[model samples]
Target: MTATVGALAPISRAACVGGGVIGGGWIARFLLAGIDVKVFDPHPAAQRIVAEVLANAERAYGMLTGAPLPKRGRLTFCASVAEAVADAQWVQESVPERLDLKRRVLAEIDAGAPAEALIGSSTSGLKPSDLQAGLAHPGRLFVAHPYNPVYLLPLVEIVGGAATTPETIARAKAVLDAIGMKGVVIAREIEAFVGDRLLEALWREALWLIKDDICDVETLDDVIRYSFGLRWAQMGLFQTYRIAGGEAGMRHFLAQFGPCLQWPWTRLTDVVDLDDALVEKIGGQSDAQAAGLSIRELERIRDENLVGIVQALKAGQGGEGWGAGRLLKEFEQRLWAQAGGGAPAPDPTAPLELLEIRVSPAWIDYNGHMTEHRYLQVFGDTSDALLRLIGVDFAYVEAGHSYYTVETHLRHLGEARLGEALTCTTQVLAVDDKRLHLFHRLFAGPERREIATAEYMMLHVDSRAGRSAPAPEHVLAKLRAIADAHAKLETPAAVGRAIGQKTRLAAPV
Candidate 1:
């Protein structure tokens, strides 16, 4: 009873069972991808909970990239599982951990869903085989484990049951990819899958440390956050250790540290007892660490931190930072495509109004104004919008050509407070086959008060060759059209201004 590769159609609508955190997240991901979602949860407050999660997802996704996203799809809360799966092309079951509850819910979903639709279980550790045991069409049922905050994180582990066909897995992967997710298919179905197995091992060790008084929860967290966590974000444990081998690689590193495997450094073999006293101690410590903040407040803090980390990874030190960064880049391109292929028809008679953004809390400095570097970021995004308008885009850059800013002059006229809405306008000052000169103005508030101005000289370059190059004829034609239109406008006062003292002193001897 497996859905053939051709049987699975593009998922324009989806059904989600049990609107808890995980289920709600799946709904958010689907809706954000512009897929209408029908959700069924027995809890009376399920709609409120799902709405809260959706709001957070919307905020996080908005901050994650400047590329436009598709208009949000409608979310329908259904009274019954049958109604939810009535017209859905994809059915996602995210009930409680109890096998009996899950089995019952999945059976109901299977009974109601379309025959060609694929069914996925959001089980953290349950094997897909067990979940599909008594199902009428077990071949269509598989585990699709997603991390928390599913809309933001791209990874989803897809584990097929014994009856599951490769075509089913391929269909699942295709659907996930359409929503900007990386679906890692497991070669075999196993308990806990991959990510949670590693996580469980670390969790056991962290528990032992706390029980043995070796380190408190906060201290243990700090150790990871300040040390190997950063390295792991970019290079995983193996690659990080391979670099430690210096000139040699993984083989040499393994040979040097292989003996450590026999050491008594880990408490993985034994389980830590969660006694009353230990539980109390851990709970007390956690409460103190939280400092009386509400759960919602803590969630907000965590989300902001995650956003900052992902953004840093996206920028990386060089270009692509880590696995997560690469995924973020790919997701941005998808968003660009959804937003009408990133093509903007600039009104060349006036400055091109390219971007409007609100200052995020993370961008605020100690003085309560947007940080200096963030201004540059806004200008950079504005430049990207301009490039997109003039036939320079991801495909153009992928072809080994792009514009590199050779010089920039920035003038700060006013301050942007946190949450202040701002807009950016760009004007083509001049253009040539190899160079582009542009000016940008940043305005804040309803009155559109000027906050900053930037002038940039950008050069077309063969990125692979690491040298300047002439713009392609098609691109040059677009730029020329823009320049011709812009030529009719008056030159900006800041265009050719240089930073200097008003009255220059006499030349030094």
Candidate 2:
């Protein structure tokens, strides 16, 4: 069966024609999205290079989110482009940036790949029209330029050639969306596309500054990273500048800074010469900036930082997420929704196993065990799982009625170390029209033993009204079914016990 997240149907098979840096990244992203990939690259070290890239992608994905990723797709290294693209549903070409080379390779792919297969080129600056010139099925090809570390970055410029049909562009975009990527179709193809154009402008200015000894590479990087770069990550260029307009808005802001556009300070129109002396100065400063870290080490550090930033964004805007983080939130919602709908029936006599989690490295403390607040987080998530099980979902909450946890009692029984698998079982203690009583046990580590327990008192409320209220009968009925079934089990010893109550496992570890 094809593995799918959310309700999006993923492309079943993909052919990646080049396995260099960008190629490998494309391959990893597709495979992680549960699409089998066939790869063809003639470079002797291509396999090893792709393997390393895949390892990093996996580590990054593990830290990125706790949502259940679909099962990984099978990877096969093929000898020829024909073998790889013979029957693939999608084809990606990541060959080096030479128009002639790309056309030659795409010709073979065009002949061997299924006529209807979606094909994309990873050319940073080349136009899709130039690359499509020699293909028999030119309408199937487009430029899908992505940034470095394609797996983590969400943006992919989808620029169609003159010969490319609208249907092909739409299909390409659909596949990108299904794989949790953002594909912005450029209205018209240009030499360097949108992102690279902006980047090249900045690079030109930076080069001129270095050539004139205005600032070292390190200093230039620090200035950008410490200020506007942060804003750019969450909000793009125009949006950031719009805020600069202040209360007056973009028109006023543009009028304020518009005069600066003609200033002589910028050398954007002039190209900086990369003479030997200038190259040496820039290269030496870059070496010092690296501070002795290897390329792979720097990549890992960058990946970790990107993961944290995106995760924080996902928790931003009051948990509604912002920008790309919002997309992640929506994607995770779909994953959870699909999983919930397809889950098997729970054993009525036992506590409902509502959630399972992997302890991410980000959650570890100096003690190297799961940290203090994460316990509360786990139990809170467990409660959320129960709430979702009983119909307090996004729509229910959106309607302005929800079960609010009024009280929580947590008993941390033992340590939960890093990378451990954990699960939570919740037993409903009592249910009423306006209140809910629940007991939750958390199992940690490979053994999945009981490591913690939480008891909660939730009050149903009309959030818009700011008062307690009865939940709809539909919700109450499901609650009644579970609470009645749980009534058969003996009450937990800690059910009503306050903090500091004596028990065999109560003493501090």
Candidate 3:
């Protein structure tokens, strides 16, 4: 008996069979999505290792988005595969990539998990058909190969074996969507799925370059990192090449470059000898490139860089986003939907407490305080939060109407250092159909000392018409309600302060 894909409930409970790098990443991503996870790993250091990965994941997520994330789910370490899989909605096998061992463990999982529970194998280079050969419910097993640092990289190659059912694939995709992952289903099962196949070809050529002494590891890295690597990160290969074809497009690109495939420029199909000298040479060069940073340090640096790239992409093209950035924006919207469309209706009479920002290490400047522009960024975010509270959002703005800041007054009084937790409050000073007035206070630490204040005057504009316009009644209604409630409160002294006017910072809130 099989359940229709539509009948499948959202995945809330999951089981993992390994606790190394890949499996640890899987556990972290699931836990971050608020999915409870059960695990069985015989490694003695599994608990400590998984904890480190989860910490890194939490840090990365903080830098990724401001959307309200769900409460993190619980995790349990079990003594056996059967114990881990019991009652699990999904089971992921990420043990050593050996067909025989995977078959045995999956058979045990099939016996213990719910009959309809889907099973995913994290095999980088194994055909799922081989792993499913001996399982009683082979139709539920497939490959869900993910990249390194799986928590940060969103792509997952979903491949199903011959025995796998369409319903199973559909259900898995639903699970991926629920957790903000991008799963590209393979049309057929094969070893080393699409991503790895391309990576391996590149790896093969790269090794030959090193072995033949054309370039050392660092030089080779510099070549890629400084050139096509960036292009690959954004536009990808064929699309980048399409643009390279000029106005004639991909057809011209192929016509010009297709013949080069036969040239000896790449030794992609050739394998270099892994003799002791070559191995030592590569290892020595790699250590030199690392400059003695441990794996954890490197991982954190990589995570931060990835976050910066993704965030930039998310803000590109007038906030419409591009490629993976578009996916990330959509994911944040889904998160907002799950969290009741953002910050709840606040006490109308008081300043609306919108968000608390942890001063990231990245925010500190040469003088070791939050940089000047970040203050404006926080104020801008507060204004956007207010927009959402009043039924305005990305879709609202994209629909040809939005609030644009025409005037802003910002004052700074205190220093914000790394790791200092800061909170903000927004006060609705005034509002009408075509214009809005807002005041925000930035507070630091437990004492809630006011460190900064910002006032903004915004004009609603019809984007398509390129002129100021009256906002819709529905949006005006929510803003008016808050304005009315706040009208009774005394106005913040920060209001109407002239540029360069001197004033003492107030006491704690």
TM-scores for every predicted model: 0.86, 0.85, 0.87
Cα lDDT tens digits, model 2, 31-108, are 888788999999999999999999888878766766656668889999999999998999999999998899999999
Tell me the lDDT of candidate 1. 0.85
| Candidate 2 lDDT score at position 406 | 97
Following a full C-alpha superposition, what root-mean-square deviation does model 3 have from the true structure?
5.7
Residue 351 Cα positional deviation in candidate 3, in Å, after optimal superposition:
2.7
Clashes of each: 0, 0, 0
Which runs in model 3 stand beyond 4 Å of their true positions?
1-9, 341-350, 358-374, 393-404, 414-422, 431-435, 444-451, 459-490, 503-509
The weakest ten consecutive residues by lDDT in model 2 span 1-10
Tens digit of per-residue lDDT, candidate 3, span 1-509: 00011111287899999989999999999988878899999999999999999998988887676666777778999999999999899899999987788888889998899998999999998998998887888999999998889898888899999999999999999898777788899998778989899989988888888888999999999999999988887799999999999999999999999999889887776788989998999999999999999999999888877776787778787998987788889887777655544334678888998776666555668998888988998889778878878878868988999999999999998988755667888989888879999999999888888899999999999999999999999999999999999999999987999876675567699
Residue 50, candidate 2: Cα error in Å is: 2.7
Instruction: Give per-residue CA lDDT, model 1, range 85-143, as digits (tens).
Output: 99988899999888998999999998999988899999999999999978899989999
Error of 1 at 290 (Å): 0.5
Once fitted onto the true fold, the runs of candidate 1 whose alpha carbons sit more than 4 angstroms away are 1-10, 337-350, 357-369, 396-407, 417-421, 429-437, 444-449, 457-493, 500-509
The per-residue C-alpha lDDT of model 3 at residue 21 equals 98
lDDT of each: 0.85, 0.87, 0.85
